[model samples]
Target: MRLEGYVIVSGDGMLADAGGSMPDSLKFEADYRFFSTALDAVDVVVHGRKSFEDQPNSPRRRRVIVTGKVASLADDPGNAKATLWNPAGAPFEAACAHAGVTEGIAAIIGGPGVFAMFLGRYDTFWLSQAPRVRVPGGHGVFPGVPERSPEDILRASGLHPTDTRVLDPAADVRVTAWRRS
Candidate 1:
């Protein structure tokens, strides 16, 4: 199965503002467009606990959230779709196997540790690079990994840039895609 990740980050490498605020309206729209595009191609969506918690209720497709315990959305099941799994015992590969995603696309959204766990296994990466934003204490685009040029990391991850376009040339946000060889 092909596993991937999709995220939007500021030029300074901040995923969110220092106060944990979300992207601006325009950025949010662009992000949603990318997310929707990814969802349409993938049979299942897998995300870390933080990503799951940050999402609003939605009942559109099957989603798997990797966490210590199975997540519950009973209070709003009508709007929340997808299942939850704990990746503690089983490795990420096993979890994907359990989801029956033996082929096609399987996406893993952010939360650095999760990315690190599955980076070597994915076949693609869809990254939205926003223009520089100054957030002194904000979270970075990729945390935990050793510091290196984004290009080097992408190369080491077994992925190479395949396409790139400016979502808003004036704003300097470019959405790029990389494919595993």
Candidate 2:
């Protein structure tokens, strides 16, 4: 199965501000369209609660939410097409099967922890960066921040940039596809 990750972070490597909210600076129309289109092709999306994509089709889209609240895998109370998966109690394949996925792309969206969990499994990681944006006292895309770059961690995980797509040249918003080295 193909596993992919998608995230947009500030130059400082932040996913959101310290208040745990996405700042206006990270919102770009081009990026949104790109992300949404990419998501539409995935068979299933795996994420933590905070990483759930708020898209129009989210209600019916297959999803596996990584959470400790469930012992194994359980149907999501909020969404019929979603499942709550606890890796500690159930295997990933089981979660995927429960989420109605046997193969195809499994998109890993993030809230840091979720992104780090699949670091080594990603077949491709699409990283979007807004170099000019800085979210002071914000959440890093990975576990360790300002000290180590997200690119550094991705490199360590055996992924390298394979291509770049300029989403918004004016805002310096660009996305690079990282593939296994």
Candidate 3:
């Protein structure tokens, strides 16, 4: 199965501010549009409880919510199209199956812990960055941040970045898709 990650981080490698919320500085219309379009192409969306996407056709989409609430795989009480999964109790493939996703592209959306969970498994990680934004004393995209950049972690996981493309020059939003060899 093809697994991918989508994330936008600050210059300091943070995804959210100290309040456990994404800062306004990191939110760009261009970035959101890019993310929304990419997500539409994926078969299943895997994310933590707090990392859900709130865009068009979200409730109708197949989703696997990685959570500690379920021992294994369980139907999501909140959404009929979603499943609750605990990696400790079952393998990722099983969870994907429960979400009705067998062998297709799966997007990995996150809230730090989920990103770290699927660190080395990503076939392609589309990392978006706001070069002018820096969230100091904020939540990082990965577990070992402030000590290491997100690019460093992806490289260590055997992923190489392609040429970056500017999404919003005014907002300094740029994206690079890191693919594993």
Best by lDDT: 2
Model 1 spans > 4 angstroms off: 18-21, 25-28, 52-58, 70-81, 97-100
Using lDDT, rank the candidates from best to worst: 2, 3, 1
* True lDDT of residue 23, candidate 2: 88
Of 1 and 2, the candidate ahead on lDDT is 2
Give each model a TM-score. 0.77, 0.97, 0.97
lDDT to native, each model:
0.63, 0.92, 0.91
The per-prediction tally of clashing pairs is 2, 0, 0
Query: Model 1: which ten-residue window has the lowest total lDDT?
Result: 71-80
lDDT of 3 by residue, 1-181 (tens): 8999999999999999998888888889999999999989999999998787789878778999988998999998878899999999999999999888899899998989998888889999999999789898999999998699999999998999977889999887899999998
Q: How much RMSD separates candidate 2 from the native structure?
A: 0.8
Model 3 ranges with Cα > 4 A deviation: none
* Model 3 weakest 10-residue run by lDDT: 52-61
Candidate 3 clashing pairs, residues 3+ apart or interchain? none
Q: List the residue pairs that clash in candidate 1.
A: 58-79, 63-82
User: In candidate 2, what are the lDDT values of residues 1-181, reduced to their tens digit?
Assistant: 7999999999999998988778889999999999999999999999898776788977767999999999999998888899899999999899999988999999998889989999999999999999999999999999998789999999999999999999999999999999996
Measured with C-alpha atoms, the lDDT of residue 110 in candidate 1 is: 68
